[model samples]
Target chain A: MAVDKKFVGKTWPTMVYEVGKEKVKEFAKAIKSNNPYYLNDEFASQSKYKTIVAPPTFAVVFGAKLIEPIFMDKELNLNVAMLVHGEQEFEFYTMVKAGDILYSNTRIIGIEHKEKLDVVAIEIMTKNQYNQDVSKGIYTFVVRK
Target chain B: MKAMYEKNSIDAGDTFNAQQKIDKYRAIYYAGASGDFNPIHIDAEFGKMVGLGGAILQGLCTLGFTADAVTTWIGDPGRLKKIKCRFSLPVKIGDTITIEGLVTEVHEDTGTVVIKVINQNGGDVLTNVQAEVVTK
Candidate 1:
């Protein structure tokens, strides 16, 4: 099924995600990042940030979760098996830390059809529970027929 | 240079190193775990056909790694408020990605930190990256 171009500007309802310390460490270990700043509070305190900081890419996990419901909608007819991540861009408003409750609102930015493929772009604007914008990410996915 | 601290906390930029390597198997694992089966990431022939020298790592995988970098720095994954990045180049196998970050801004009122990443090869940048995290 072809994706509807009219849905390009649709914004999904906001979803909330909670940050966890263990999960962050697991992700860091999986990626083999041994940066002491992520592991030792003492070392982090010596740096300019003072508090422990998260790695830059950690948003994918939470952001992706927020977008999952949209793709699962039956009306979309998205072929999950034939989907490929084409590109991703993140614009940051602030650094993320553990214990913050994140709220994300996703929107479909663009849709283009190329022969047998449908290219869809989704933009997610995430904020803390306090309602301050923290980051915005644009992700492109290609769905092949 | 005097070391700067943020409210007795470490800044994300100060914890990152200028050198790191992305292993081939790690790329494969990321592809599997993330369900991103791009041919250019798993098939050398397909990669070459598409103009890449060989199988390249998925851009999302690198992004995921960057997320890991942020979570590790904060000491708790739960404190993450947001993260954002951009991909400038294809990361091939054996490419040593030197992740670096610079604190562009720190908001004390909101407790947010902004940073960027660069893939370095012999001191030359391969990719340009940026992200932000809100601390606890």
Candidate 2:
């Protein structure tokens, strides 16, 4: 079944994620990144940010929480077995640092049904504890029929 | 060294590259860190049953590698303002991924880089990759 177009404007509940220093390091190591801004505390402290900043792709960590719920949504009934991430796009307004609390809100931005598959795009906007915009991620998934 | 894009010296056709080895434990570590516990990425038998041959690496992890290449070239995490990619192929555990960024356009305040992520077999894993960074 194709994903219903009515859910195109649907929204999900807000989720809050606390960035951890160790997790930031773990993510960097997982990606095999040796950048000091994410790993070396001394190097990061002396830098302009004066703190260890999470990598650009770290947005996905928090963004995933919002994304998962959409897949599990009974109304949407996403076919998990046939779904694959088609593409991803992110626009960062500011870099997030360790210990910062981020609030994420996701909504369905676009839904299209092609001949063999259906594509759904979710836009997630993350904000800092101070209400400053951190990053915007557009996650697109293709569900094959 | 500061991770600032040298606006004056860099122009279209400038390039930077980085290579990462996807070790055996890569998928496990990435699954734990990213909270993506999909069986297709963690279970070899399940992957084979699903026709993926064996457990495949997470697409997001590959994207992470691509982002690492970009930030490594710029030398600062904050300098990267935007990045996107299409997951074109399945990256296995032993594959060596290489990311190459070509400066396609440069303006007063920003530069656009066209990135290509390829595997050890010269397969394009992430195609149509583009990144926008702050140069000013």
Candidate 3:
């Protein structure tokens, strides 16, 4: 079945994620990034953020939470078996620091139905504890027909 | 925001390069951290069953590596304001990818650098990758 175009404007409930210092370090190491801004607390404390800041791509960690619901959404009835990540775009605004509580909301922004596949794009917007916009991500998935 | 480049140091046509090795267990660690438990990334048999040959690295992990390339060049993670990329090929374990970026445009008024990431393999792995950073 093709992805329903009606779901294009649908949105998921807001989810909250609390950034952890160790988690940031773990993520940095996983990506082979030894940057002190994301790893060494001592170095980060003296840096501008004054605390360990997550690497820029760490936005995916929080963004994934909202994305999971979309994949699991029964109404959408997505064919997970035929889906693959097609592209990703991220815009970082404020630095995401350790211990910052982030609120994420996802909405279906685009749906392109092709003869052989369907491309679904979900836009996720995250804000910090102060309600300052932290990051925005557009996750595009290609679902084969 | 602090400046990543000198007032007159940056201009269009500047370039930088970075490379990363995809370790054997990179996918497992990434799955643990990112909560992406996709079998195609962690389960070798599952991947082969699905025609992937073997377990493949997560696309986001590869993107993370690309992001590292940009941040390392700029010398600050905070200065990296935006990044986008299209996953053109599957990144298998032990594949060494080199990320090269060229400064295509420099906004003098905003003090931002626009960069395009290209694969050294004739654009086989990652394509249409680009990033923007605030020099200020």
Stretches of candidate 3 off by over 4 Å are: B1-9, B109-123
lDDT by residue (B1-136, candidate 1, tens digit) is 1122222354434445444477767666665444445678888888888778889887777666665555555544444555544456677788877665555656662344444455554432324455455543
User: lDDT tens digits, residues B3-65, model 2?
Assistant: 342233446787999888888889999988888889998898999999999989999999998
Which is the better candidate, 1 or 2, if ranked by TM-score?
Answer: 2
- How are the candidates ranked when ordered by TM-score, highest leading? 2, 3, 1
Give DockQ for candidates 1 onward, in order: 0.19, 0.79, 0.62
What are the chain B TM-scores of all models? Answer: 0.75, 0.90, 0.83
- What is the per-residue lDDT of model 1 for residues A34-145, given as tens digits with 9 covering 90 to 100? 7555555677676565755555566666776766777787776678767766667776666666677889889999999999999999998889878788778888888997
- Model 3 clash pairs are none
Error of 3 at B88 (Å): 0.5
Top DockQ prediction, candidate number: 2
Residue A107, candidate 1: alpha-carbon lDDT = 90
Of the true interface contacts, each candidate retains a share of 0.25, 0.85, 0.82
Docking class of 2: medium
lDDT of each: 0.65, 0.89, 0.84
True contacts kept of 2: 0.85
